[model samples]
Target: MAQPTTSILCTDLGFEWPDGRPVLSGFHLAVGPGRTGLVGLNGAGKSTLLRLIAGELTPASGAVRIAGELAYLPQDLTVASDQRVDETLGIRAKREALHAIESGDVDERHFAALGDDWDVEERARATLDRLGLTGLHLDRTTGELSGGQAVLLHLAALLLRRPDVLLLDEPTNNLDAQARARLYDAVAAFPGVLLLVSHDRELLERVDQIADLRDGEVTWYGGNFSAYRAALAAEQESAERLVRNAEADVKRQKRDLVEATQRLAKSAAYGKARSVRRNDPKALADKLQGKGEETAGRLRGMHTERLNEAKERLAVAEEAVRDDAEIRIDLPRTAVPAGRSVLQLERVRLAYGGVVDLELRGPERVALIGRNGSGKTTLLRTVAGELAPAEGMITTPVPMRYLPQRLDVLDDEATVFRNVKAYAPAATDNDVRARLARFLFRGARADQQAGTLSGGERFRATLAALLLADPPPQLLLLDEPTNNLDLASVRQLTQALAGYRGTLVVASHDYPFLREIGITRWLEWDGGELHAVDPR
Candidate 1:
């Protein structure tokens, strides 16, 4: 099939935060029909660029040209508490006008309001059903829906508009497996200029191409996420080889410069000695020595210039090599013995009325998987002793810690340092700083208020506090750990988990991440029952 024409263009785009932090400057982008996944590290301005294109925020300088109507779904979606389904879908006005005309009003204004959209209600309901919101009443309020449902409702609204250009920013951040599958279908069926900014790997894999936004620039990679990753890995390997070759050249140049200097010194000394042996006059001898010195100096300058040029080349080559840091820490104290029972739940009925019976021994990594509102979070909280089971007994033999999905463990008013200090009162300031550095909060960042940090930064701070808490939690319970995290942050979380030697019970919808941490068992919660399952 022939490719669709370009519908969105950005030329010489420039934007900065109110505090003068530069985001995009002299940036340019052109997006045609088909899906394009926008990916980058946290705080790389992907969301800001999308907002600029959506006209939610004006660019400091530049032009955004669009050929057709556009729709945008932001990362954080909010609807009025009393907003009706039809109103959210933007068809309430037409529906109301149609109803008024059907009642024998026969007003030309009603016809004008209806325009050519006589079946607007039918289309709206069809769009909602397609997005897994089946049986939802048009007059139903948004306050009655779950977070995942609300996100789907927002997508349904955009689909109902039939926009020629659609921009989705982290659309699947709060979606469950079923909801995500529905979204994937919607995206696959879209016939428009689609630009998606998301960290969901599965969603990215479905895109026609990947647009990587980095360092205030955009670079397009052909094909999906896997292809993009393959291309990036090849580029990094080549860059690393170039750096090595450049380093070798710099070393060789430095060695040659040293050898040349020694040769010049020997030649100068030999020339002076010959002049002395000739019994030359003192003034003539001095003049000869001065000429020899000047010649040596010029020769040295040539070699020095070559060495400096080689160093500059090396610097450029090094710059091309990416410095993607990984989280590395050793927590031997958090390790559990091989035969020790870490946790036991005896027919435990949670506050949500879900029954779980399980015992974890040693340092097993357990993956908890379920749909939204399936009691996964409730189970984790109960296991962490944050909530008492409604019935039966629960026992944890070691220190336990829970990292909730909202990441509210830290006090917003306190600095990251103080928060961690509060958790580990016996730990010294230097020790706390050292641990925080492992979580990528180094120096002044450790002193920043928890409330002031970005989402990814705040997550790292909370993780640092949990891992560095007093007694060192041996049983770690993480609830939806990868939600709202950027790709780099997700990788960092995986790397941190790799270094953890304690028992882990992580409730998440991220399969790739669970596999990365070497989950030993998979448990699925369905209809208030927890049962083991094969993750594959």
Candidate 2:
């Protein structure tokens, strides 16, 4: 595809929180027209860069330059319940003016308000329809729509603007499979400068290239998500090889230094014996000794310099290698025996009107798949005892724990250790600390307050607390667990879950994640009932 005329440029950009914590410092980026997937670990400043470009935030230093108009759809989109759909789309005045003109109002202001957007309503509806939001009334309030529908509606409004540059942050976070497909189409069709910040791999695959933001710097890659992964793997392999070579060089240098020292010691000893045998004058012997000492000093200095240089190279090579740690956990206590009655629900009416009649035995990993607002969460909540079922009986033979999407299970004021300790009250503090280390929270990190930890850290802490509960829950329930997680964190979550041998029920739209965690059974919740589905 040909490039658009638009561009985004950031020159020596700098930003810091009011508390003096710096995020970006002297950052520079220039992106011409192309779909660039911006990705990094959580809190790597992807969203910050987008917000800076969108002018929603003021950088402490430098400037953001754009060739043309820009539109931004932030991750946390909020709409008042009473806000009209037309008003949200930024066409209420124009729509009213068009109506007034059609009704024989000769007011000059009406024509000015309508301006050149004569078919604004048609265009708005078309945009909505393209995003799978057809039949939505412009006069309706935003509160009437589901969360996913509201997100699509906001995106439709942005599309209607037809700006030269578009910024999207976690656009697919709340979208279902169907809605996400529509979004992917819209994104692919956008003929402008597009910068996307998302953890959704499927969405990232649609981008023309990737701009990996790390440590307040951007590294450009020349293809989509899959290509980026391939290139990154190659780079990492080369980096690891370099590190190995550098380490070998350092060891060789050290060995050479040792051998040289040994040779010098031997040479000095022979010279001393010769001096003694020759019966040379004291001054001559002293002069010989001084020369030997000088030579030895020079040789040692040269070897030391080479060793330092080798060590420096090794440090640089090591820096090029990424160190994303994996979570390693063992929860034998959580394992459920075969033929064990994990959970049973008989004609259970969900809060949202869905009926579930199911019995899970043993350590079955069940994936509850469905569209947004399809009562998956309601069913999970009901199973967790967070919500009362409208009707029917529910039973669980083993202890259970639920990790909600919001991750509001911990007390903000308490430390991570305290939180886990709260769950495992009978366990010793040392024991809890040891287990927390397996979750990548070691020593003092376990003492960090839950409120102060980053998104990924908080998640790990929450998972540790749940899995390490006093009774060691034999049945685990998770609702939208992958929803705001970065890719690395998601992998870590998967790793942690791999060790869990209990019955698992997860409600999520992340298919790849569901597969990675080894979901044994697929159940689709639709039309107020659950139905078995093939994985294919």
Candidate 3:
């Protein structure tokens, strides 16, 4: 295959965890201009590779070669609450320098700092406006901004830098639909080498190509996520066909060996019988019998060799096949019968100013969607009884569980088994183990500390604990469930929820995920109220 000219290159890159577990080894990648979506399973080193490229981590071996200036937007964007919006935008000093020079202070340092960037504030404002942050004032502190707003502000800062290469690792994780759309636009507008590591299907759709990281190597695929899926499907089909043909060949070889052995035995016996019948001399007949035995042994060895070669070919063919396992489980105990009233809120005034008057009934999968800071998370929290409404009565008749985005349900120090056991104290250890196995945490996997788990594993552990609680949670509230999750994890979560026979309220920006899980109703939080929207 012909390769693109290298703009960002990682040659023989290698990294290992502190505990000595190797991640990338002798890995090589070369990407040119245009957005490249780096995708893989949770532990496939997507984030690690991004970090390496951004120079946040030193590779244990090999080198990262970049053609120009680079900027990185990490998954967790941290900004101090006291930081001014201008600081977050990376123009605070320039603004100060310009102001000082305009105020008649003839400081050479101010002139040097300003450095002909007189329109710094204007550019900052323009960038912020482009990212849908027009209302954000440069003087305002980051504390006044919502999480999604902060992420956009950080991106705006990166834009102000005007880098030649951009690396975004799960940049849309904390963003809402509106925010994500704005980010998508910014990503599309970026005229540079772009490397994005994300599971956001929509964000990935904006990419020029996909770099699939697996088993410490990258396989490039042209086009977006859907195209990549189509290619992967085709590849899998071919691999499966090869495996089937190889299996048939092995079977034919085995049959041939068996038939050849049988024929050899029959011939040998016939030869012995004929020698006895036409024996001129006993010694001559014995010599003839020995010769026949020698020929039979050689024939057997040849057949055995053929069978072994066929088996090796089968193994090689099987190695090309992928094992993408799905999570499967039954939640019979969580079933809420039709017409069962799960929750009710009467003129509920949230602490953040929203008035929610809502009622939920049996097995209704509700999608709670809105712009960031529009109170989706707050509403979910209120329903889960984590927060008391300022005014009004909130009632949930059945037991409920809330899975927050942080996945704080599990104790970081505890094992997955122990975490689930904590939620279901009455259940025996064997019962917990059996249930954990369904979440793909079997045997030693269940014994690992929750803190050490990847994003997908952590989510599964949290979900398992919540669903396996003492009363089996007749109502489940999930806040941003798909945020930062890999595509496979999202699929697993969707499958798990498919079996959930209770009232479900999922606050997420992931529309595709909402659609996949069969959301029966759509509720949008706007103007300080929850309004029902057409399911379409």
- Taken over the whole model, the C-alpha lDDT of each candidate is 0.87, 0.90, 0.88
Ranking by TM-score: 3, 2, 1
- In candidate 2, what are the lDDT values of residues 95-163, reduced to their tens digit? 999999999998999999998999999999999999999888999888756567878999999999889
Report how far residue 507 has shifted in candidate 3, in Å: 1.3
Residue 290 C-alpha lDDT in model 3: 89
Model 1, position 354, has a per-residue lDDT of 76
Candidate 2 residue runs with Cα over 4 Å from true position = 1-5, 17-21, 55-58, 79-84, 96-113, 141-147, 408-434, 442-458
Model 2: number of backbone collisions: 0
TM-score of every model versus the real structure: 0.86, 0.89, 0.92
For residues 1-536, could you state the per-residue lDDT of candidate 3 as single tens digits?
97434389999999986646588999999989999999988768888889899999899999999988899998767779999998877788999999998899999999999998999988998999999998888999987566688789999999999999999988998697778889999999998899998998888999999999998889999999999999999999999999999899889999998999899889988888887788648888888888988998898899899889989988988888887667898899999999899999999998878798999999898999888877787788787778888999998899998998777778988888999999999999999999999998888889888876767778889999999889899999998888778988899899998889998998887888899999999999983988889856
Highest lDDT: give the candidate number. Answer: 2
**Candidate 3 at 277: error in angstroms?**
2.5
Can you list the residue pairs that collide in candidate 1? none
Q: What TM-score would you give candidate 3 relative to the actual structure? A: 0.92
RMSD of each: 3.7, 3.3, 3.1
Give the per-residue lDDT digits (tens) of candidate 1, residues 440-487. Answer: 888877888886565677788899999988999999999878866788
Each candidate: how many clashes? 0, 0, 0
Indicate the residue-level lDDT of 366 in model 3. 92
